[model samples]
Target: MAVDLGQFDHPSWLTVAGTGLGYALILAVLTLTMFIVPWLVFSAL
Candidate 1:
């Protein structure tokens, strides 16, 4: 499910920017949680 913006030049970048940012944010949160949970559990012990 990729976005195809090859036809449009300027607007293509604009549309993808928001979606890219959102995807990046989600990835960051998931990655952080993976490490944080393990650290918290070990520290508690």
Candidate 2:
């Protein structure tokens, strides 16, 4: 499904940039979390 950017209030450029940054930050956090969780659980055992 496609979003209708023509109906939104935000400028297209800012929307694109913000979405990219948000995805990148989320990906980094998940990657770090996956690596740290295992070590933490093992250490507690």
Candidate 3:
């Protein structure tokens, strides 16, 4: 039996742009956390 692929289609540029922005934001937060956590631990000593 053949499996049916639903009506999914390519996303618009807006959707693609939003996804890019989300990824960038996630990266920025992770980078900041890496720097901040080390400083906080050392400062507390």
Best by TM-score: 2
C-alpha root-mean-square deviation, each candidate: 6.1, 6.5, 5.3
lDDT of 3 by residue, 1-45 (tens): 976554344567668889999999999999879998889989999
Per-candidate Cα lDDT values, in order, are: 0.87, 0.88, 0.83
Best-first order by TM-score: 2, 3, 1
Candidate 1, residues 1-45, lDDT tens digits: the string is 999867667876777998999999999899879998889989999
TM-score of 3: 0.55
Candidate 3: RMSD to truth: 5.3
What are the runs in model 2 whose C-alpha is more than 4 Å off? 1-10, 36-45
Selected candidate, larger lDDT, 1 vs 2: 2
**Weakest lDDT window of 10 consecutive positions for candidate 2:** 5-14
